[model samples]
Target: MAKFISFAISILFFVSTASAAPKSDLWERWDLSNEASDVQVSHAQWSIFLSKYAAYVDPATNTRLVDYSAVSHKDHRVLKAYISMLTDIDPLSLNKAEQFAYWVNLYNAATVDLILDNYPVKSITKLGGFFSFGPWNEEIVEVSGEAITLNDIEHRILRPIWKDKRIHYAVNCASIGCPNLYVEAFQSSKLESQLESATRTFINSDKAVQFINGKLILSEIYNWYAVDFGDEKSLIQHLLNYYEGPLYQQLQSYSGEIEYQYDWKLNEKK
Candidate 1:
């Protein structure tokens, strides 16, 4: 079975990488093709697994801690099945909204699967690959016969196609510095509301923006995806959309250079 799966993935990687055409600075929208149509893609299986094992330390901080050790053997099998179901669905056949939800959920799910397969790791960055520390660049899943990686889903597909800064919130890296993973799987029906809520919630968290020595220290995500949030002034405006209280007032009054930091510790439950 493992050999068969490996052969299948090899073919997918060749096809997906070989047929790629040049993309413009902007990615084309999904569901724009003449053959595109709506299709049902269920995330129930993933939601069930999450509800059984995921939890937030405190609602106020939105710090999620996944009980990796608590995940039983049966649940792992269920997760593999969910990933298989997602892989079988042709994302090109789904509408724009469903496509967006599909990629986000798939990325998050794949990330979890990677961590689970190598449980007890202190950090995701510990999952070393040929050229990098983390396995982000590894093509761990295939969809519609196209082998895809976490980086491909986030950078190549979601980020460029949507051009929405809120995407950084929706996709979690299973790290303490990353945004909290949503307990419920993202669905096409609630895509808009979920995206809005994710953005608002993350910005309101101390991880998003905070003061240190009177300097505004932001997440390295904003720096890494600087273009996604626009200029520093514009990024501040975006944060103000959800930030409040004394820090909000401080951000409003203080105008200087902003620094960034990130913690790669696993978001595992104690």
Candidate 2:
């Protein structure tokens, strides 16, 4: 009876954690994009919001924290307006780069709005209900008359459409362990460099990779999205692409077990 109870608990734990990471199933509607189109989506309002609220809390780690509690009523309305503007735009008419930037900014703006609506909470996971891990599954916005959840923007739209592992770095979950929310909105003109910078900043941070007493520890983002990164060896290679300096050398020499962890605490300014 004891052994059976232990096994059942293990299975329950696996299910809970695994279910939190939705698989990258393609949403065919979002697959439509014009590669040759020159239209650009304006993220000016979002850029203004980010500039006012997001800041680098830790220079050494590049931890860009958001001031959720500091958001004014007027600024909150501006955020909603920004999201509404994005919803009104036809992403299919824009080029692939524009669409990418559009989705990323929309996802981030909506996430911040969600947190503000439920401020004074200790963590994002606290708002999503008893069985829910976080608000990712909640339908927070509607684009082109279709209601969309955070998971849809990430797993269904961004991940499947781009197939770039860096997509993981671009989307923020409003958590300390996740990549910093860009201080400026992602622009189509600088999307490549922005993604590259986000990836490099994250991989070098202790939140993403840490070597403690000879053991290699990584973020749960890597473990949850392992398929996006490929097998264990492939994962290391992917990390190497962004990792630099002495940490780069440490990773090269270390052939050991990798452990993964994540903190769901809100990435709020102190």
Candidate 3:
């Protein structure tokens, strides 16, 4: 099954690129014809996030990684079309408040595609080399008419300005601890609801915290961003807010073994 899947990926990669021919580019450097799905990102606000945030992995050493430039032409056309919608729509045209949220969502989603592009076989940590910070690259995105790094976005904009610790949960780095990447583009109207849903979904998922054998195995994200999840509140409280159904109740008074682990593997075509 694995071999066939990989083979199919290979065929799709080449076939899609055959008809490439177009002109004019957003962010200027990247083109759509040869690399259409790259139309994956838009919005001038998101420009900063893509320009500043997102860790870039070196494709040379990362043999097991998925060459996004290759396969982006295929897989999930609706999602790609939505991204194109972003490009076609004038972000400046949106209201100031709406524009900010639009950029944030675009940046986060585009980053997901960037990681999936190199979506590697080993842990995401493995993708980063000696000089690399993590398996991500801030360079994959284009923003503010300049290419920026991921560190800039996280430390500078998202964390500081938004001041909402829960945001850490909203932007999935395609890591296990992160909220699962939303299948579609995050629209401005849905920002607040999206963040709330993303927080709830990620915390409750098996990847973050799970109720198994009367124990609570948690994700490292909780530990790393414990303060963001309201370090003021006990870990139990944090979990309760983000989880619902039985899990919420189970965590109320439940004390069990605490386990934390993360998966860096790309959330590829399942």
Candidate 4:
């Protein structure tokens, strides 16, 4: 009986870990957009909030951390208001660039708002009840009369619609292992440049790639959303696109096994 129980526990653990990385499935409703429309959604409130709270802790790694403990009650309300404003906007009315910026900013702003609401926690994975891994699956907002979760915004809308690998860098999970949350809100006019910058910043950082003991260590993001990055060879090619200097040469020469690691600690300011 004891042996069987242990076996069953191991199987359960495998199932849970396998299912933790949500697949990139389309939600359909968010697929709608106006390519010709010039409608713009304002992210000024989110920008202001980021400016006040977000800071670079390590210049070498470009790790941007948020001051959750320092957020005043008034600023918290402002952050909430920013999310509310995003929820109220009709995403279908905007052009492709605007829509891209909208979803990325919304995902990021909502994530920050969630952390602030549940501040003092060691990690984001601690919230959303016992059966939950994190708040990603929780219905945190409503858009176009349908409830939305962080998972939906990312997997359903952003990934399916944009099909840009850089989307991973733009949508933060409020964790140290995740890509750095930009200190500024994404704007439509600067969306391409922002995405490019984010991709470059993360790819070059140790969080994305590291060479340890002559082996390749990559962020778990690559493994979780492997489809977005393609096979191992393709992934290396992708990395090479952003890597630079000695690291770039090392990546080109290395042909060993790839290992993945992630840190789920809250990316809070010290």
* Top candidate, metric TM-score: 4
TM-score of each: 0.85, 0.92, 0.59, 0.93
Candidate 2, which segments miss by more than 4 Å at Cα?
1-19, 59-61
Backbone clashes, candidate 4: 0
Q: What do the candidate models score in CA lDDT, each in turn?
A: 0.80, 0.88, 0.51, 0.88
Q: Rank by TM-score, descending?
A: 4, 2, 1, 3
Candidate 3 stretches greater than 4 Å from native: 1-96, 116-123, 133-138, 145-147, 232-234, 255-257
Candidate 3 structure quality by residue, lDDT tens digits, 95-177: 53454455566556555555554554434444455444453443644454555445444544456545575666656565544
- Summed over model 3, clashes come to 16
Which stretches of candidate 1 lie above 4 Å from their native place? 1-36, 58-61
Candidate 1 residue pairs in clash (backbone atoms < 3 Å): none
Q: Can you tell me which runs of candidate 4 are displaced by over 4 Å?
A: 1-15, 59-61
Is candidate 1 or 3 superior in lDDT? 1
> What shift in Å separates residue 119 of candidate 3 from its native position after superposition?
5.5
The deviation in Å at residue 235 for candidate 2 is 1.2
Q: Model 4 residue 146 lDDT?
A: 91
Which TM-score value belongs to model 3? 0.59
